[model samples]
Target: MEVNEMAAEECKAVLEHASLGRLGCSYENQPYVVPIHFAYDGGYLYVFSTSGQKVKWMRANPKVCVQTDEAQNQSEWISVIVNGQYEELPGPQYTAERKHASSLLAKRSHWWLSALGERQMRVGDKLIEPLFFRIRIHSMSGLRFTDEKERRG
Candidate 1:
């Protein structure tokens, strides 16, 4: 999709409001998709995962795509798509990003402090037994389906 068509602010809003998303990549020319939790920073996606198949696959192929959606009610919905390259964030990088992400998460009224709070520590300590990847977005778009349908892609 053409980058000019997408409004950066609206796309960012959609990303921030949605926590769960689908990470898409390829393995042996076969496409793969996995559900995961993510944090959307200024223009990047932060995802945590244990070292295993997905992480290995991503390493072998850093290119990826992600989709996140949110619905305020039956009458309205918004979905955002991010196309990017994935890179494992090093210790220092993860620490800094984790602190910012955790702070934003903490600000949400529905956020479970105990669970998300513990994750913050694990992320800070790089002790989740999981690999942390920073998805550097190259292009982003959003689609809104409310009383009217609008798309930016």
Candidate 2:
């Protein structure tokens, strides 16, 4: 199918509302996939993580895939697969993106702490330092529930 045939608005909505996805990357020629919380800003996927093994692996290999899905029924579901490259946003971009990401965090009621309210972001004192990453979407493909039905409406 042609890329232009896909619904841009639908894909954007999926990225915005979906909170969890499996991020796929390879290390040492072996495949790895891990569940993560992500926020989308129309063009890129922002993921928050503390420094550790996963971050290290991603740094080594920037190219990755993010897959998210929602089931509407036993026979129907939609999934978006984003194939992109990850890069750590630096300097001014980092500052702005972090604030933007924080707003997204503040709006969500799914988690307990977030539901309670905003906490002070003490940059220097926090043990697990926050990192913001941008995944630049190179290409994406989605499967709709009606794909099998030849439905294009």
Kindly list the per-residue Cα lDDT of model 2 for residues 1-153, writing each as its tens digit. Answer: 212234767877888888888999888998888887788886888876665667788899988999999876545678899999988865784798777876774455236234222332444435455577878988887777644343342
Q: Give the top-scoring candidate (TM-score).
A: 2
lDDT of each: 0.73, 0.73
**lDDT (Cα, 0-100) at 99 in candidate 1:** 69
Q: Which residue runs does candidate 2 get wrong by more than 4 Å? A: 1-6, 90-93, 109-128, 146-153
Residues 2-77, model 1: lDDT tens digits: 2233487889877876778999998789888988778778778876565667787888998899998877655567
Off by over 4 Å in 1: 1-6, 92-94, 98-128, 148-153
Task: List TM-score per model, in order.
Answer: 0.70, 0.74
Candidate 2 to truth, TM: 0.74
